[model samples]
Target: MSPINFTHILTQAVDELSESESYKGLFHQHTDGNPLPSAHALCNIVELARAIIFPGYFGNSTVNSRTVTYHIGVNVERLFDLLADQIWAGLCFGGDGECNACNEYQREEAAQLAANFISRLPQLRRVLATDVEAAYNGDPAAHSFGEVISCYPAIRAISNYRIAHELLLLGVPLIPRIITEMAHSETGIDIHPGAQIGSYFTIDHGTGVVIGETCIIGNNVKLYQGVTLGAKSFPLDADGKPIKGIPRHPILEDDVIVYSNATILGRITVGRGATVGGNIWVTENVPAGARVVQRR
Candidate 1:
């Protein structure tokens, strides 16, 4: 065979791929001087957040009453810095090709959003404490709150979810999804950042759990591994694309328990104090205090 013209072929391939039509809708053209969001920075932000929320368990092992305030104050300051940059990047990324004025506005907005998120840290910590307590108390194997915070995948996933959810609520674009996806990738737990989860939420053996967008889970809800709270079908627009921002996932009221591998679909409600047994598939509304299980 004749020798192949490798350089010529590569040049042709690059030329073809670089064509505007070929790369359109697939490429993000970043504006000059605008920083794109960094996954590494976000990872650090999440770590700092965890450290602040659970001081002794995560960042500083020697934290006590004397040093606790100092540790938290330092971490919070650092978190604000990192989170603000990422939030700015997210805004820049999703902005209509940036103007200098728009970029400046986004920068200011990002700082405000970061400060707001930081202010919510106390409330976030309170909610996470409930989650930790729920995990430790729900599982017989759990020995301590430290164990739940340090060891449980649910806590890790839920913390990310909580953080991301708050960011979503703050109107920061793109970054919240990225943060939750980071946790999902690490833990095999898929929680959409848009999901609304109340206090004392615990997921046992959390692998393969999927909580879809628009799922409203109330307080004291315990979900075992492999449970799926997903949409049955999406409502499409006139163009046949699935409509955005519709509430389609199931709602679990307070004190509900869904067992492993159970699949609950649609906009149904799992009423308060209900129990859904393992491997069951539910599409209808479950009554309050009822038990749902697969029939023999």
Candidate 2:
């Protein structure tokens, strides 16, 4: 048999891959001195956040009343340093073309944002406690809060969402989405950081749940698996591009429960104390306390 020329083939492939036109808009030109946002580092950040928020369940298993404050203090200090660097990386990656340099101002802003995010951790924990309570109370399968925290995909997904949401609020770009997406890949639930979710939110069998960007979900809301809060249609702009940043997803009021595989779309509202049954398509506003179901 003839000898195979692997080197020539690999060189040709490399040349093809290096073409500017082929890589245009697909490649990120990393000119800034700071590194790009690290998914690995963000994973560590998430772990630290979980540890701080839910003591003893994550990180150190021996955390108790006497040592809780000490553990949190150490975790918070480490989280601040790690988060500041990642935020700075995100800022550098997404900064304007004119601001290509990794300036001291960017670093300062990243540190300030990280501090603000740390400050919000207590509130985040408070809200997450509500979620844990809701999950425990709502699901017959859940025996305890510890089980919910340790075993449930919903907690993991929601924790990530809350973390990403806070980062988004702090105006840290790229990293927030990356944080949420990491959870999405692990758990089948997808929640956009821009979605406004209130307290006591719980997802039952949370896989396949998709909460779109701009979705406004109120307190005590429960969503079953495969529910999609999405846009019905795109509103095109003058250049025929989908209009950006308009309210496209549904508004789910407090005490609403959406059953599995239900698709609620558009700028419509699912009013307070409502129930949306499984496998239905709702594009219009549903009045408060109403129940929507698929045709018999």
Superposition TM-score, candidate 1 onto the true structure: 0.95
lDDT of each model, Cα atoms only? 0.93, 0.94
Off by over 4 Å in 2: 95-99
lDDT (Cα, tens digit) per residue for candidate 1, span 26-112: 777666787888999999999999999989888878999999999999999999999989988887775444423346788889999
Our model 2 lands, by Cα RMSD against the true structure, at 1.6
All candidates: TM-score: 0.95, 0.96
lDDT score of residue 240 within candidate 1: 100
Residue 34 of model 1 has an lDDT of 74
